[model samples]
Target chain A: MAPMSDSSAATTLLPPGSLPLDELIACPQCDALFHARMPGRGQRTSCARCHTVLIAPRTNAYLRVIALALTIVILMVAAMFFPFLAVNVQGFTNKASILDTALAFLDGGFMATLAVLVAAFIVLIPLLRAALVIYVLAPLAAGRRPLPGARHMFRLSEDLRPWSMAEIFVIGCAVALVKVSDLARVEFGVAFWMFAALVVVIVFQDGIMCRWTIWKALDDTRNR
Target chain B: MQVDDLESTGRHAEPVTARGAGLVACTRCTRVWPMGETRCARCGSELHSRDWRSLQRVWAWMIVGIVCYIPANIFPMLKTQVLFTHTESTIIEGAIELAQHGSYGIAFVILFASVAIPVGKFVAIGFLAWSVRRPERLHPHHRHRLYEVVEFIGRWSMIDVFVVAILAALVQLNFAASITPGPAAITFALSVIFTMLAAQSFDPRMIWDHDGRGPDNHLTSETP
Candidate 1:
């Protein structure tokens, strides 16, 4: 990396004797730089070196992402209350939900933290991310200035991307259900299907999201 | 090889990094700013051409991850009580038992997500961190790809922990049968979290900083 000297300068925008900084784009994955170009609708710009999608702004993408985010939020809430799985052995039957599983360790002990973490990983983080996306994009989707702190909220959602593991949780449940099927009769509950759909929705939302578009929108409009 | 590939694309003969042009991109919003800028005006996030302390943070979190991983493997992941007998199984033992029961698919998923992925993450993150300093040991392009894979797969290791949680919650029968998370579940979760932090703390930009190979005039004198 070039030596980052001149630490005394506090100006936020200073392009000295070069192309304007706003016209430059760097691939997040491989750090390959490129002169920024707005892709046509239904088109995307990928890093030539590593093929990471750098810019992809589809028409009405923000609105679509908002719709999907709403679905994630609704499904996650329902998945928490409804039974996730039911086990029957010799007429004895019990059903459990995601909330139940998360609180299973909360009766008091070091495990209480684990319970909270489980709830956070599967339920809380995803919910928060969806909520943040909606908050950050709702105004932008409506052709208005972003709500105050939209930039920060968008960044927060991006940072939490890896921590949101609802999809992994669903796969884990599938594996656990199979493992337990041998011991007893196991049945998927309504919440299981909801979680499955939630996974699909989450994946679709993430795939369709174009971070550059959102950032550009946030930049173009000054938050009120 | 990377240069040749970039050239074949006919866009540029080689990659041009933001830092090479005396610019910094916001980690959150991907907005490029001049090198002197300390924060992104668009997103209000701190900007750095490269995080100088990234490798140190990577090693610190990696050590914690490794420490938690030791107990995660040694202790039982789940405990089950049936009738008057109790059985406990660690992660690998549970996978093996599943395999013996002919649930090879679930077993493989468990083994891959729980064992192979985590171990691979530790190794990959370690190598990435180590290779940053000794850049000549591995091709930077390959290292960059490895870094991406490690970041993407680190969270999936939570599969085993989720499996334990779901099984414990679903198998709660009054006296005939019951299952609960063992001591290892929390440790395993911690290991996954720490490893993820380790991966996140790593600055991938360091991989490209070894030489001045951008589209701009190359700097013959190394910064450091």
Candidate 2:
């Protein structure tokens, strides 16, 4: 490479494209120069040295987004209404749903800011992002133009994607379980299973599906 | 000339002649070389070398770790217990519990660092890798941004692990309560570490491969 430049730095920030058979590029992480042989569009590739994953080109973008959207909706419903865990102690038993847990915190007199942040980031953000992705993808898949607010929705989803925090919730649960082990009994609940499934779906969709197809569709749309 | 020499021999010698010459220095050895030669006569080492590229294996591991991440989050990571009673909680339940208990700040922190950031990272890395595999030149801006995002967020995934560690250390009440890590802790930690490694291993140079020009030229020409 000639030398680092301001414009090049800016250009580097964009996402990868969906074209096939590209030359190998340097590792963004280490600045190590190398070549990669493209297998096909949307196919996953790996860095030879550090083994970082590279995604393949976009093909069939709309279908993937729709499926993910549906999955997100189902998981969100399950997470909200279902019992997340059951606790039993000294012959007394209790089960808590996601909403119930949030209410419990409110009952405990937590600050309003904390409560809102937790609800929005942990529950609302992920759901909204998933929904937005679906919304954007559905029209694109049908070969029709997105609605007037589609761009804004997509932007919102992108922004929210960073703030959604589900894994932290899992960690808290583990800590609570451990601390409470001597005092009471604990049981798995439907909400817990549903939540786990939700996380899985989110990861899969964000990591593989959305990045590949949705982006390609967006690029094509932008070009058109 | 013979008559002049004989006359000079009796008196003085002819004036001596003097000449000037150019000197060359070897970049490696600092030794002088003939004025016309290109190669270093002594060391024979090349004057330049390219930057190191990230290995493809790192990306492969990232892809594998991402795949495993799906199951890690999906499956019941830890089974909780109290007084011989057991319960299972996923990441979502933990957040809800925190929210319910008025520990919304902690809950949101954990949620963002562990859940949202990691998932976002996976998607970003996957997209970059996929783009690298394509022949089409990616938008230079997006590629750079993806690199920064991946690197910046990779460390946040440790929020869950940190929370676990903090709780395990802090929640030690003999006979009243005790906190113990579950099987999922190890898996979760591994997933985070693996994804981080994957981010570290990605070669950003792959972004420029589509331009079909040397990185040096791109860098120089693109400079503002």
Number of the top candidate by TM-score?
1
lDDT of 1 by residue, B35-117 (tens): 88998898788877777677789999999999999999999998989999999999999999999999888889999998999
DockQ value of candidate 2: 0.04
Chain B TM for prediction 2: 0.62
Per-candidate interface DockQ score: 0.45, 0.04
Kindly report which residue stretches of model 2 are placed more than 4 angstroms away from their true locations once superposed. Answer: A1-42, A45-55, A58-61, A107-110, A210-213, B1-224
Q: Model 2, B149-184: lDDT tens per residue? A: 787667567556435433343333343443444445
**Judged by DockQ, which candidate is best?**
1
Chain A: TM-score in each model: 0.88, 0.72
Worst 10 residues of 1 chain A by lDDT: A1-10
Question: How good is the docking of model 1, by CAPRI class?
Answer: acceptable
How well is each residue in A1-224 modelled by candidate 2, as lDDT tens digits? 11111111110111233222112233323232223333454345433322334334346646865797788788888677776766655556656666544333232232233345456656888888888888877888788877556655765676566566665566557655654454567776787777777777777676555332344345446546
lDDT of residue B200 for candidate 1: 91
> Once model 1 is optimally superposed onto the true structure by TM-score, how far is the C-alpha of residue B70 displaced, in angstroms?
0.5
